[model samples]
Target: MSRLRTHYPLRATILEGRFFQLSENEILHSISLEYTSELTRLHSAYSIPEPDHPRPEISSPSFRIYGTEYDEVNRTLVGVLALRWIHFNDYESFVGCQPNSVKLRPQSFNWICNIYRKTIKSNEDLFTLITSTVINDLGKAPSLTTDYAKLTGTDINKVNHDMILYQVIHHPAVAETLVPSLTKVSSEHKHDLSLGIKLGAEFNFGQLAQAENVPACLSGLKTDLKNNPRAFEMRFMEQLLDIAGAAGHTDYTCARKLVEPIFDSYKNVYDVAIDIISGNLGLREGYDIILIRRVELLQRVGWKRAESLNIRDKEKRALMRLLCIGGAASIKTADLYYQTFTAVNLSRTVYEGLVEGLNVDGSLEQPAVQPTYLPAMCGLAIANTANGTTGEKMKALTALLTYLSRVLVIDKDSLSFKRLPEGVIVVERDLRQTIQPILESAAFKHKPDILTDAPMPRDQVAKMADGYEWSFTAISI
Candidate 1:
């Protein structure tokens, strides 16, 4: 019943035997013209450069149109997301698009036809050449080269990680794999990765469903073992990662990069023998896997709420800045140092647990060196988002130090934290007086759940992981 429909204006020209160049600028321009700030990623979006050099950069300026802005700049993925948006529709079978030709507009229809020698007949072939050009171009980006060199991990590993993040994880097919086997999904909630993605794309184009019904679309996504009885045990983790990434969780990019490494770590550290490819982890209900999987629910709920009500991305960032500030406060309270492992006191049981957890192979390798401070590092990453420049970072830090000094914690040798306040301050003085207004500046009339939801399961896992590390570092345990 909606007045607007999805289509491609270019399908006719290509059908007439005339090849066209797929100009990146033209495609982005059409998107800008058709979509609104609420529809697409107006600020901070996913970008895919190439299928070969697959790294999903947090892109921007997809081409500034008339006056409004669209964020996220990946020629390949953006184009595909746009294509899906044009082609997909409400029917569960997805029957709304023009069957023969893409709905490319005349002015913006040119794609990379010059490189083709054979007639590019199938839509797939054209897609391939177009994305290849994007990937080749992306591989050559100055920022990519710089960032590639700077990764502490090897270049090959970095590219591999990026490929997994963009290509393997974000593949439209990966989500589709779940459909046939998806179990216990209600009539209204029969969501697979394919549908969720299509819905998200539609949402990006400002075709989001009403707020309340959005849950039905996402309910099929939430992983209740009872609901999805036929769930593939092994693919669950990857599916979760894909869903979460698609739905927009903060640390997913890093999570995807660490997937294989973390799998190896789990095998080594916790002795979790998970075979990722075969979908066979000997254990039933691995909490680590669950920890990763449940985040999709958080992202789905949060994103639906935000998009349904048309909340702007800036407001989201402002809220995230506040959350990061809170994270910084917790990290500061712990006084956890990452520079070098300093001795710390822990209770006997805590120490014993650390010994057991850290020393899976009986030998305590670098017992004194506990890298349990990754959570704090996560915190720092969040807090740093408040400022971009050296001056701004300095100011934020100053503001933080000023705020923390006000909390009445017992000072202990400037090394260990002995609690005095015995409770979280909830909000510091500076944050309450100055920061709160900035975050809530533009009223976000949406559900606000995305801004406020906590990853309870992830937090528990983090706690356990940190506790194990603390056991290693404990001065007394």
Candidate 2:
């Protein structure tokens, strides 16, 4: 992780306008003018030819840049979904107007460049990082909204934008921009660069884990580039640089404090979970694992309208507060649903209502909200809940586990429940074996007392059991 720097250079004066409308040649000229010496040095170091083909100009930049929009035209959602749309120049001038609303700001070409200069100090990462960031949000283009809807059968609100990006990587506009043919460029250079861009665009393990029944490599980029370790490294660098770039955006100390931990904990939780299942108790050769506590902050959407529409965002947060857990992966689509017991004064009814409401279909904001994976373990972290009673934590655990059983099929390993769209077979035994050790490790480190408490009712345990021998104090870590 990059150390927190007190001062960061502001926007480059050369990139001040709507450059996306310019021709590809003009765009390249402007970039070269801004970083003439740096590009010269990088091209020499990497032995790559300068971009020759005229790339496609970016169009419709307002898609997922701001979060979900629901108007009458979408047909699935009622009422208007209010989203923030501000120019890149406005974001450049943001000092401390509203720290909580940073996610609302969309990334313009200038914003991308500002972050890029701050984060990428190494010459080795220059070309891949630049290309990846440029085309990372191609799926967010409004020109592809109808195509996205057709691909997923869901509104833009609930679609996987990363998948959409991967799907259109070969489209004329996107292909010309990302994987363009050049006169003197080696095929390997073009192939590897294209692979790196695709890897960065689609390597969203967090979102994949959050979505039910989706494998970590559902987008096929991982399988495509599995043999290319350099491509994977480039993808990882892009993600790290992204976080580092955001950390430098403001002078606000609180923002740095909030993001610094996520930067420091570089190990992927999903990867660690995989290792545990493979019978490797040791940490990965070079990486040290840390228990990451992620808090889903409030989005700047229309609250009154969302509440009227019974949007599940607020309800999930309410449940998080009540359960007192930092983070949890949902067995369904309600990602990050983890807690131990009541952290606030909210009634148990509120917690119960939140859980019960989630069990029903077509009740929440999303249409036809159904559980995708059966016999699947919803990974939840029980931490920072030393304040709760043993009985309270136990009851909360029972309630959650029982609810999961109702939603996911725990009895049989039928073919329908076993197979995922990406051809990954999720063995029930492997999932049960995997989640137990990880959860136990997290609990042992964060809240040790719960391991010694008595078990929940036998009937409830049986209903929700994931084939792990039921025990209250099975502290494997």
Candidate 3:
């Protein structure tokens, strides 16, 4: 057994108000003291900010320390994963956390709690919250999978966890006790609740299992279907909880803020693209310099491996930088542009159907203007990772240029994307004219004498073009 499991009994006893028994064994007393110290240290490292209103007294029996069949060890693992390392074995659920224990509350957590307390007011609501938290992972157990597969006379490997959950929850023996607890939810909603849970699990696990095969944008589509019309908040809740749980293990970092809130007040992705074309000093000097330096830096590293760039933010300046690079690449290699569009968001099986030349087999014509290239933008970020190819990076830069000329969005929201009407496509001549001055200016900053080398001999034009084609205006800087 794991060390956690071995110590579960002692931990459970202490949590269940048997603290008086700790002095019986000298070793146990020492262990208790050590545990207490760890809790204190954790609280110091991960203290939560005080919320506006006092936190509710969460006295539900479901939140009790030792009621569920899930032992303290398993609960601790779950707690660490979804609860920001707030161990279930430490106290009587989240609301009853000890003063010294770390609480993992963020702004999002407070918003969720407020909604739950004000809107959801029934025994069934409580059950929905509890079961979604604890029992959601029941299908993940190997033993359970084996037993379930045997019962259904199916191959264990072929039995998906979601399918197993759907069956187990509705099983005659289990449903007899489990189904009635959802007293307030209608029959239709009860079904949605189960499906939402299944979809949420898939949303979490599928991303890990099929990272390369699945597009990042479409990773949550399955869950979103359940959440359409905002009918099933439980799905979103489960996803958040699962991420919180696993965050204890994952080394997540925030992206660099490329656009401040005031500056980020763009109409949409397309608006940002237009702003890039208009060319602010920051765009020319800041973003352009970063791209040029980044590409050169990557080229020097040669292609052993590439780590994924942290390019997931929706800030305008960041989006503009992406649009400038990836869009330009797509135009330079229209075939690659089309190939990337077809390959993006399509399932792994569908992508395999495309011919090697990447000719679109269907009757779908090349879009007259820019299509929503959000997925491709995201894919480019992934391609820039340590393992990414030189060709992929080059393609990304070229595509960004194309985006500067031909971006559009229907949505007004800056945080999310929505497709709009076809925008004017900036051709190669226009792009070169607009970008050349900026590149020269950038070169001048690093080497003041760059202009002196003006109107370079004809022999050097092809070399410069080659450099620009691959890395987009390779300034020496």
Global CA lDDT computed for model 2: 0.31
- Estimated TM-score per prediction? 0.26, 0.36, 0.33
Question: Which prediction has more favorable TM-score, 2 or 3?
Answer: 2
Candidate 2: clashing residue pairs, number: 2
Q: Output the worst ten-in-a-row residue range by lDDT, candidate 2.
A: 76-85
In candidate 2, stretches whose alpha carbon ends up further than 4 angstroms from where it belongs are: 1-125, 145-159, 171-174, 177-190, 196-226, 245-258, 268-477
lDDT of each: 0.25, 0.31, 0.32
Model 1, C-alpha of 436: deviation from truth (Å): 12
Worst 10 residues of 1 by lDDT: 204-213
Q: How does residue 288 of candidate 1 score in lDDT?
A: 28
TM-score for predicted model 3 compared with the true structure: 0.33
Residue 71 of candidate 1: its Cα lDDT?
Answer: 23
lDDT of 2 at 259: 30
lDDT string for model 1 (270-335, tens) is 222123213344222222232222223224434332222211233232222222222222222222
